[model samples]
Target: MSRVIIRLLLTLLFLCPILAHSQLEDIDLKELVAGAQEWAEENLDTNVLDALPELDRQKAQKFLRDLQKQFQGEYVINLAALRETANTILPLLESHEETRPYAVWLRPRLDYLKIADEFLITIPPPKVEPGEPAKPIPNPGPIQQRAVWIKEVERRPWPPAASNHVARLKTVFIAEKVPPELVWLAEVESSFDARARSPVGAAGLFQLMPDTAKRFGLSLWPRDQRLQPEPSARASAQYLKLLYERFKDWRLALAAYNSGEGTVQKLLERRNARSFDDIAVYLPAETQMFVPKIEAVLLRREGIKLAGLVTPRD
Candidate 1:
């Protein structure tokens, strides 16, 4: 299958559960699959399609399928298996100009994979009692995970693209009345790479999804403004500002940014929670990791805690 088809299948397998109660809840599974297959056939990147035929089809399909499964699995511990595959794929993706944008998207996430593996190695598995089912061990809470991520991130050098983009992006955030330091979000999202794109269609420096991008006044056709740093940054900042306003807390705002506002809001209401920590465990594993990862990135880049961030100025 083509990469597009593979991604579509993986999305259906993994993301459907996460989206079940969100806006896409009512979507018909069969129709969604048929539409995705048609889109894949119609919109396959010629270069990628051409390249696919030259590979050993079975091996390639297996590799791609396994990669997608591990990457999209609900548990962070599953990411451990992806580290080697990521290293191998990163260089290959970077070697082709047509595929380099994917490399940009994958590059920063390699850190997450590495740290997740380390976390698994460091934390002992929960002990099981005789004649009882062995339950999975829960990950450390966000506060503990944030400290771990801060240490990991602190040792890394700043992404080169950030030097060129941060000043410009910060100005856009400030113009949108967002806290300028929050512009470092690009570092966490895309490593400040304007061409970065997730397989699920989030794009650009801030990785704005199509729906969110359009909601914030970005044009998707004729030209995808999400790939333009200033426009994407403006949309991102506005979205963040709106999220912060809704949650009245930066940690909650960041969580909503990653996992959808509806998802975070519902969790908060269900749990009677006012803070990210209260609902963190109930969140999808990616969101659980994501909020703390951003906190670590912010702390490492700007030396500010999420709680220390000020509201957008008028």
Candidate 2:
């Protein structure tokens, strides 16, 4: 009897903790990642946790810490909030519960992550600080101005001679991985006038609308540099490059450039187009014509000499 009672006591003691833990509901990596994805998509600006790499989870945690430090007065963390934060951040990289269809607790959180991801994609990369030792600048000889200007002239855009400035602008863009076709957009939108203004409050040679400019963290101060022919061209090119990384298709990227990425993404969700021409018509009218015009000019310029024309080299 004594031996049996001892054995029973030992079993109960071991089972007690296990039963308690089970009652409390244990969360693990799988649960955390799912909860995070759902929560982030629903609440924050975008699901920053998703587009960024999985190895960066520690960094994301650090970011949260930094945020906590920066705004100590504004935010506080509790158990529930920590669970929510984990849910919002983790699934962005890891999806563990492949078989489980749904976690009722995690669904609401993923909604916010979706929105956060949307906004995050639009945010430009941080700029390198000035006063870092300057790198040697390479000199690109000659401007592709006439090609840029004549296209503007054809559209009856002001500043008829503006296309002549393309060669000068080309130098800045050549080093960057920007598509050459985008240079013509500057001409069509702003007439190569650094101080160009549009009826809808688009400014700069690139005609970046104020909201679009702001989204890139561009400041509208005494004068928006985005309107400046050279700077605006660079900004536009960089923006396009970023879009290309997101969509992988130049046409879809261009559509995202003209319209918002959200718009392009929605269309992609709808038409699921395989090529630019397939989805080009779905873009805004001006954007619809935008790609073709740029293509036409670029093709003509590249093959002008082949076409038996005296295309001058700058």
Candidate 3:
């Protein structure tokens, strides 16, 4: 072989691993989209389409377009290529933390992609004729279906006793600089019963478990401080703030509050899913309904008489 051929071969050998590593990272991101789709399909209640802002849609669209350019050499999507891409990303996502939610959320949309024979198709512009006005292109079928899931949450049956504690919880949450609207959550947990105790040992209006109570500075040694309304309310607010920081979404934060942050975190790992709604079906039945119950109470308190039970959102 000539010296030039040998040099080129050596250079390619050196660059191969670096290129492979880059592709691995790219695959993880693709898995995130897939996982999100999966979760959305798994939980039929919430609309992943409506929750996203314009910027997020644009970002996802851009990411999808980038992947298309990378893999769609001939400009046609095929099942084998899509399957190979999914297999590469799903395993890597199993152990991931931060991006795991996105993966869980995106994976299920593959059915729609396969059925529709595309990922996301552009809504075509209006068609015009020589004399007639332009006829607007209709919203595509998948997007229209996705939009159907977006509905307003309805009010729940509020225990009269629950409203009695709202004034106190408002004080506690406002003192902590958290949203006072969260006061409604206690209504779902324990019907605002200060001395309430769950079958699993969660106590007080918030029904915090033992470890969670201790983590928020509750003294359970000489006496169970979780039974006290004032201390328990404060601790609950503080804990919710921490959960909000961790999940960055109120619904997920509340899920952590109900099921233990560790439980939710582990659940996120297991499903590689997104928000509470995305992975709701995989959670304990009580934990699954926790956020919706909270939303229902909030809507009732605000005097919005919605008829049906809509999915809870962030």
Give the best candidate by TM-score: 1
Write down the lDDT that model 2 would get: 0.43
Candidate 3 similarity to native, TM-score: 0.46
Best by lDDT: 1
lDDT of 2 at 38: 40
Write the residue-wise lDDT of candidate 1 on 1-314 in tens digits. Answer: 46676544434422221221112323332343335434333322223323333553333334444444443334667667778877876766677554566678878778778877887888778888999897765666777788888888886778888899889888888888888889888988898888886544567998887777777999876577899999999999998998888889988888778767777787787789988999786665566677788878888888898878765566
* lDDT, candidate 3, at 165: 77
Candidate 2, residue 217: Cα displacement in angstroms equals 4.7
Q: Would you give me the overall lDDT of model 3?
A: 0.50
Model 3 Cα shift for residue 254 (angstroms): 1.3
Please give, for residues 1-314, the per-residue lDDT of candidate 3 as tens digits.
34455334433322222211101212232343345334323322112222344554444433443333322121222322354444444344333332233344334323323322322243345677789986633323322322322222342355667667788778888888677777766765666766454312355777666666776888765567877777888888898788787887877777666555665676677788777656564443334444554554566576432223232234
Ranking by lDDT: 1, 3, 2
What are the models' TM-scores?
A: 0.81, 0.44, 0.46
Candidate 3 C-alpha error for residue 114, in Å: 37
Candidate 1 lDDT at 70 equals 43
